[model samples]
Target chain A: MAVVCFMVTMGLYFAATISFLAYLLRRSEALSKVSLGITAAGFVAHTVALVARMVGSSAAAPPSVHEALSFFSWMLILVFLAVEFRHRIHVLGSFIVPLALVSLISAAALPDTVPTLQPMFRTLWLHVTLSMLGTVGFAVAFVAGVMYLIQDRLLKSKRFNVLYSKLPALDFLDDLNQQSIILGFPLLTLGIITGAISAEFAKGAYVSWNPEQTWALVTWLFYFVVLLGRLTVGWRAKRAAYLTVIGFAGVILTLIGVVLKSYGTVS
Target chain B: MHVIVVGLSHKTAPVEIREKLAVPGSRMGEALTRLTSYSGVKEGVLLSTCNRVEVYSVVDDIEQGYGRIQEFLADTHLSLSSEQLTPHLYWHADDRAITHLFRVAASLDSMIVGESQILGQLKDAFESALSHKTTGLIMNKVVKKAISVAKRVRTETKIAEMAVSVSYAAVELAKKIFSDLGQRTVLLVGAGEMAKLAAQHLIAQGVGQVRITTRTPQHAVDLAEKFGGTAVPFEQYKDDMASADIVLVSTGASHYLISADDVQRAVTVRMNRPMFLIDISVPRNIDPAVRHVDNAFLFDIDDLKQRVEKNRAERLQEADKAEQLVVEEVGVLREWMKSLEVTPTIVALKQRADEIKRSELDKTLGRLAHLPAQDRELIEGLAASIVNKMIHGTMVTLKSEVNSSNGAAFVESARRFFSLEAAPPQDTRGESAVDSSSCLAHDMNAPLVEQVPSRTASRKQP
Candidate 1:
């Protein structure tokens, strides 16, 4: 049942991506509504699937790459929907929903083993989940940054229809970038702290200095500096938007390092 | 009845030619009266808008109806000779006319496809025809169905959702930038006509405050009074830009009035808040480099015009989708019309059955002349009930089949199999005869139902 629901969630996400893309071309309110509804439905299915997986898998098993990726995409959509409803930027889905699909597709490409979660009854799972959500926040900022660049280009180039009309305002995308970073930074701080404490619990050392651990700290510092710049001097979205890409790079590297480590242990 | 449409639209004739042949609203009743006065026309409607002038009518003969409507068109617009008018007028008859009406109502045939103005115009024209009493059962059904088809197109296709006009495009862009125009302030620079129209549009969108500035102080002051706002001196407009969220510049001056440095300084004064600059002047009053300024978006007239062009292209694509919907609805209306044609046949078949039953009952009764009165009454009831039950089944099946795809074929076969056309439903051996038997042959101009409406009110002495 868990596996079936997981596939169903993937299918719903695919449909949502297509609908959002279609809405971009047509620019109709009805299509936007339908696209949002589909995304909401997909989010529901994702939650159900995750709950079913938790119910099915044994508690002692550690987190697999598949489960981590699934939760990451799920958290991204959760934040995306909250922002969408608050702002009513229908076009935002065109920029964000496809990223969810890409994440889900990556997860699907991995093995179908039900990832029960981490460290049995230990707090290490908290560490994994928090860090994953922190990465999701950065991913949201990255998507917003990408949109800002595209809108900025379209405005500067004087292309005033289709994609230009369908995109959110430059200022709105900029504000969103700042807001997501502001939200994500604290979670990332706590996420790193929890990871350090859990490292001490699991391997009897506070600092493991492993590839994933090093990458996570580096990514955290990068976003910390970014948040400081935005808070202190009130930097524009374009600069922060361009800078978020480096933080996103750190996220990708950390995920890769963890997945490789998990494969070495599981196989 | 045959439905015919004769008209000219923006596609066929230039506005100059259309204006010469146009009929205004005040003359609609008189024009419709003259239209139905023609020998072939039985019911009529005249639609006159700036883009097109058309006449929709039900007629006895398609060819002669077109000729008669053409004659009426010629009579109304004597300034334009037949040589000039004949080249522009288009005529459609029967099902094609219905399809044409649907397309027009749905705005597929408009100067700007997917515009909603045509639908309102069509409804107004239809209402005029309704009030003038120029419409009967067929015209009413066709026009009403056309209106519904237009509505269906609007809901089923995203044709009219986007703005295709330049002024409307500006508002759409503003909404994209600001999300809410209610708190935004607009600074109007120069008083060009088109720029003022756009400013009025922005004001209508509930922009917070409007400030007008022009080279002439009196014109600025008067325009400010008209717009319910204050006017600033032309030299002091730059200071006003700091508080303004939107600035519209249109002047005949060859040099750029608002330069990149000015916009840069304004953004600083507003603490980097976004400013929307629109330049509609010929030489362009705002500097193009203002777009490079942080949070400043500048659009010239050509940019808005380009946006309008792109929006028009998008609407045309949606128009294709709307056209498909219209075609589907036309099929539905055509099926309904075929069923309407079957009503008369259904009535005729029942009448023939009744005549046969009565005649045979008379023969049997004459043979049993010495039978008891009670037994004769019993026999009469039995024969009437049996015939009624049989005809009821056949009529129900016939009515049900008339709306199907091959309904016309079944109706034709039923007419032939029952020999309904060869023998009219009147009893030849009886004293009473229906003098309206001429209506039995399915005359296109004749009433489909049994009751012929008194159309005398529709045709006056004029």
Candidate 2:
């Protein structure tokens, strides 16, 4: 049942991506609304699949790359839909939905060899979820940042092309980028604290030089600077946008490393 | 007879010439009456707008009508003579005139295509003519048709949706910076006209408060009062920048009024809140280096113009589609006008038949002068019956075609197929034929029908 739901969701995401890309060219409001409807439908199917996978596994095995990646993308779409509902910026769909699709496709392409859940990993589930959710927030910021820089350059260079016309205004994108980090940073701090507690329980130490732990700390510290700078110095626009992009990259690389390490152990 | 338009538009005339020639709304009735008073002009409507001043008229002769319109223009303006105005005026006749009017109504020929203002102005011009009673049947149908064409263009295409002016472009850019202008504060640095217009547009969009500041404090207070806004002392204007979301700097100062350091300080004071600065003056009042400020977005005149140009290009592309709609509507009007000519054509045809039958009967009766009067009457009756029978099928076919979709094709072919046009305008043969055939007296003015067309044409009421 879970596999069927995943397949259905995969197909919907693919359809939504194509619909959104076509809408970008037409710039018709109806088409964008319809495209958004399709994405919402896909999000429903994806959520069902996520619940089914988690309940079915019952925390018996370490999560497979497919499940982890699927969960990450699910969180990403959740954040995206929230932003989309609030902003009503149709152009963001063209930039953001493709990220979810790539992650889902990557999950589907993986071999079904990695264990689905970890022993005692059930206790750390909340920690893992929060961290992934934090990454979702950063992912949103990345898209917003990329859009902000592109829109800024387009404005400055005075090349008001089709792409430039559709993107949200630079200041709005900057605001979104800052807001995403502001929301995500605290969740990550909580995630790090919970992770430290789990490490203490499993390894009898609060700090383990595990690759995942080390990278998470480094990413948390980087975003810490971003949030601090944002609050005190009013770090925003170009600098905030660039930092969000770099910070999200750190989140992504850390995830890739964790996934590879798990696969290396299995092989 | 033809529909002719003679006027100066933005493309043909400078603003100075257009302003001199434009008729004020208060005197539109007088201008229209004076326009139709000319010998060649049958009916007239004067469209006067900031960008163009045009006279749309139905006339007896396009060439004579164009000249008379120039005279009317010279007479109305008084400051500009026919010789001076002639170089700036453009004239279009017949089908081209209708097409031009349609394009104008659609706003395809506007300085900025798809602007929407021209359509309303055209409607007003038509209404003014309507109230003045200067418009006839042709002008009424044509002007109303032009209005409907504009409505169709607006509905069928996305032409008018693009905001293409420099002022509108500024609004678009502001939307990019701020989510809504309704609650944002606008600070006008100087009393520049374009800046005032832009700030006024923002206020119309519901911008909360306006603060006007200039080097001349009295001028600032007076201009500020005009906007119902507060006037700031020039030295204290920078303090207002902290609360102001938008800053419009359009001073003629040789040096930068707001430096990069000033922008940085304002952004810092506002706790890094975003500020949108629009510098519309030639010598930029806002510092160029302000672009480096983190929370400050500055756009000068050139940047705004580039956006306007891009939007204009898109509007022009959409206008290509609007032009096709106008052309399609013109073809429809052309067909309707052709149907109008059917009555005159039928009259001319019967008149020709009478001219032939009467002259031939005269020749035959002279030869049979020795015969009895009763026999002569029978021969004349026979000729009349034959002539009626020959024209019966043609009259029925031509009359039925007036409502058909391809009625124009039939009208053209019928005119060429028959010798209706064979009789010249001064055909004296028509008068003698009229004298003999009293029953066909109404139709006997065949040569006159060539000049005075349709029932309404001779009456002059329409």
Tens digit of lDDT per residue, candidate 2, span B414-436? 66666656321111111111101
Poorly placed runs, candidate 2 (over 4 Å): A112-118, B1-164, B287-295, B310-462
What's model 1's lDDT at B51?
Answer: 69
Clashing pairs in 2: A61-A117, A61-A118, A62-A116, A62-A117, A62-A118, A63-A116, A63-A117
What's model 1's lDDT at B181? Answer: 85
TM-score of chain B, candidates 1 onward in order:
0.55, 0.58
- For every prediction, compared with the true complex, DockQ reads 0.22, 0.32
- What ranges in model 1 sit over 4 Å off? A26-38, A58-61, A84-88, A111-121, A200-209, A265-267, B1-164, B212-236, B268-272, B310-462
Determine which window of 10 residues in candidate 2 chain B has minimal summed lDDT. B432-441
TM-score of each: 0.53, 0.58
